[model samples]
Target: MALTNPAFSTNPAFKENGQAQTAATLSAENLQQMYEAPSATSVQTDRMTVEDTIVKTAICFAFLLAGAVVGWIVPALALPAALVGFVLALVNIFKKKPSAPLILAYSAVQGVFVGGISFVFEAQWQSIVIQAVIGTLAVVGVTLALFASGKIRASKKATKIFLIAMFGYLAYSLVNVILMWTGVTGGTFGLSSDVRIFGIPLGVVIGIVVVLLGAYSLVLDFDAIKQGVANRAPRIYGWSGAFGIMVTVIWLYLEILRLLAIARD
Candidate 1:
């Protein structure tokens, strides 16, 4: 959000675990006097720390869950909640300083949108929401685990591939929506049910691709947080990092649910 985290800006090796890359003048030892430490300017940043990002992300999700629950129960409040959430997202992205209250408010509204949509989707899909929730958790958990274990890391080539896949999926969705709107088919699915690539359902194909995109998005989000912490950005900006991650996760969950439903129907 800050045109990439400061760690990325300052350090070439920002992607790896986001640990501080710059050499510290004073080690955690008695070799150097604490009082005569060099100025902050002398300290260079290399990457954002993971611990702080986790803490901030946890706080942000709490707010998101609260908002989602409210929105789920109050049908009439859904649209307004989405509007409010959008505004807050923009504010968080643009504001130089993060406000905890504002970020929490955003979470509330986003939660409402999630809940309301979940309610509608569940009504049609029947227990599909649970499946989606579980799937979402699985993906996030797996991704995080792999990342922590150094099994998966973001790369420029992979990122370019992700973007290409995303564009292809979006185009397919647009065409499908158009076909459905024109009453070309009177069924639950559009191109999803009819189209097949290599004997697999088109929807399934697209879903997998999109899910991958969402997963990669998490990588980027984590990278940003890692960068932020490395740069020792204002603690408040931690909220910004949290919000970004939350948004990506939610999107990922929704997409997973939708894909699963497509499979079921």
Candidate 2:
């Protein structure tokens, strides 16, 4: 079988053998129990399943929340946390196979950066963090529901548009960052604050666009998980799906927080 999915392609469990395994022989009664098994599970067989993915995602989230609490208490760690998290994100993306330790580490480090930045934003604008959290959850819930209902899907055309928009947004961000570093704009948000279109802060516009991209990213993640399950991917591959979802959700939350801050400004 052709292993196209990156997660499964690197896994050895999916490899097939022409010769049958010579394990301990089973009798007819043992075979009968096999047919009578209650249900298939990740532990029972190395195949992927929705329940396994959910469990993996929950574990990652637990580590993330724990790390967030630590970072919340020490807001000064935000900068370093962001730097480390970026490096880890790149590492995880390029890895041939999923590593539970690495994925969990990424989640914890990212959570630190998220918590620290959230604390900073909350200090500047009261109640902004709560609002952003709610907005993030709402977007994720709606996107998941739409996907589950078959109202939304990943298509080549929409994916092309998403890539184009992502590139444009990246270019704008690079320019904005350079301008700010050189002290060209003195405002808190640099170009986003100084530039206005239709009496709205440019950041608000960009933030809205990025938020939409993040939501679509979640949809893509869901699609990937669905495909993996259908393809009978290795159970461990669920971590990849969980990691992708966490990254997109974090991006969405940050964008929502920025948009709310700009609006309140």
Number of the top-ranking candidate, with TM-score as the measure? 2
lDDT of each: 0.74, 0.86
Error of model 2, residue 258, in angstroms: 0.8
lDDT of 2 by residue, 174-220 (tens): 99899999999887888887789999999988888899899888888
Residues 1-265, model 1: lDDT tens digits: 3236432355433334546544365465643564567734312432234555567688878877887787778756878777888898888766655677887778777888888888878888899988999999988998888877878877778878877887887887788889999988555778886777888767887788789889888887776776567665645566667777788898898798778877887
Candidate 1 displacement at residue 208 in angstroms? 1.2
Cand. 2 TM to true fold: 0.90
lDDT of 2 at 51: 84
By lDDT, the best candidate is 2
Clashing pairs in 1: 47-230, 48-226, 48-230, 67-108, 67-111, 67-112, 68-111, 68-112, 71-112
lDDT accuracy of residue 194 in candidate 2: 79
Please state the error at residue 107 of candidate 1 in Å: 1.8
